[model samples]
Target: MATTLAQARSVLADAGAFGFPVDVSRRSDPVVGTRDSSRPEPFATLPRESAAIAGEVLAGELRSSTKSDGSGEYEAMQLLRRPVARATAAATLGAIDDDARNEVADAALDWVDALGPVIAAPAPPYRWSRARRQEDAARKSLEGRIEALGDPTPARTATMLAAGTQVPIAAGAWLLVALAERPELQERLAAGEVEPIWVVWEVLRLTPPTWATARVARRSLDLAGVRIPEGGVVVVSPLLLGRLPNLVPGGDGNPHQQLARLEVERWRDPHVRPGAWLPFGLGASACPGRSVGLAQLVALTKWATSASLHLAATPSTDQTRGIFPRPARIAVVRVEGGNT
Candidate 1:
């Protein structure tokens, strides 16, 4: 395990020396989502127009949810389900009809759900097991939806949509939870006292959806002072790195206590650069749709700040599928000026 930030950075930076321990040849084409024999990067950085579309979709979803629900109560994960899925789908499925995009979005959600058991299993399930079959079915369904849109790389597109959707959904929920928990901070953001991006960074620092990632050493090598044999897995935890005093603001208050708190103002200082902890992994394997994800979060933060929201129930941590706020129930106390 990469215990220090430097070690983690080294492990991630040298993608050649370290790789994910997966047999690409054994994986199904739809799940692998490679372009061809060479397996070039299938997911690209989202274009600005696509990012804007994602932001619009997210904002509209939040507004619709708030207006349609009489009680003003929302389960963060469930509420964000369609919005994040559809937002990512709309962004990635270029120039598709609204209905086709929506279908792809729903299919992506189903695929993600189906993937839960496969990912959570301690070891890969049997190929013919119910979980694997269901997952395969869901993936094929998503791929088919993309194919219907005449997308040349339907499998790749479906994989991209699913991969992009899940993380942002959790991140968006944490953003809402953070805002709801600190009304003062929310007010400051709404009043434009603080930049929304800082809040997004803070949420990502504290509760990054992909809190930890693993890389396997392709060859026996020294990592920091430690030596490892071939295929040794090195895990990097962003959650741990985010709390380091050097990476984030913690000197003002007790360093230990302050680092853990959600302090958006901490980012006001121009010197301390954000994302030092690598909320999104670094190097060639870094998240491809990070731009769209950030746009979605910032947009959500803006919409959240416009309204008064309070936690209906305390959120519990769920590490099964990355760290996220489960049962993140919130009550919209009041709607303010307008949506962002």
Candidate 2:
């Protein structure tokens, strides 16, 4: 049978009991252990690394734009759409042949052209500064709100945002997009066969883009009979759990449907079980920008749906995990007169 939300919470709590204590303050002394060493270390330096990579990528693309050749221009356009490739381009450019380097440069250039205007227009002074002033402004605003409420706890803003906005916005946006794209789902929604909120829950539950998350074990634990030593690290994923036969109907219950129900419940009443439905992570380590990020996502979805957008014939699907699961390319085009 499908695990009820209560049952899932129990399982998660049991796992957490066997897991390591989370240090929200970031002041805890680092501890070393065998199982912990096997997992990917937290990329504490990611913010800096991302800034540097973005800078190099933009510079490389801009340089490519100077070329007069049509092929170079086309390559630049391609690169402009795939900003993530810039880092790889920068790393491999020197070792590759002229043709390969040019290709990389062109793609980088294209990506820069497409996305640069958006970045540059927002804060001209911060151009190339890498300070991310807009995000800082939002964070400060959120912090002030927390302070006014007399809650100075670390990550309080992040927690509020995750529960109040991020999850809801992501859930809504993803579902709306799915409905607009999938005719059967759209018909179902139109016919009032499924709750709109449930649609969002189902979409996220079934297609969570994030593959896994790592956690440290506070003490020794057993997983499916495998003994894990204390201070060991464990990676947990709903993707794997959802696929377990015993968790689904016919075997047990449909994990996807159960997760969907859980999401719907959480969205409707976050306080009903705080931190249990943590696609954004639980407790102190939850993402800080989740609110604004979800807002952006929701806005984009609203625009797409209103414009009657359709995905490109060959949209890209390569996704990588960050703070959350996200699509690599969610291309869509407005269908003329399709908006109702």
For model 1, where is the 10-residue window of minimal lDDT?
A: 25-34
Off by over 4 Å in 2: 1-11, 20-141, 149-154, 162-173, 209-211, 250-309, 313-340
Worst 10 residues of 2 by lDDT: 68-77
Q: Per-residue lDDT for 61-146 in model 1, tens only?
A: 77776664323788989988998888898788777787877888899999999888887788777889898899889999988878
Cand. 1 Cα-lDDT: 0.81
lDDT of 2 by residue, 262-315 (tens): 233233443332223344443334443333333333322333332323333332
Task: List candidate 1 segments past 4 Å from native.
Answer: 23-42, 68-71
Best by TM-score: 1
Q: What would the TM-score be for candidate 2 when compared with the true structure?
A: 0.44
Instruction: Please provide TM-scores, in order, for all candidate models, with all chains considered together.
Output: 0.91, 0.44
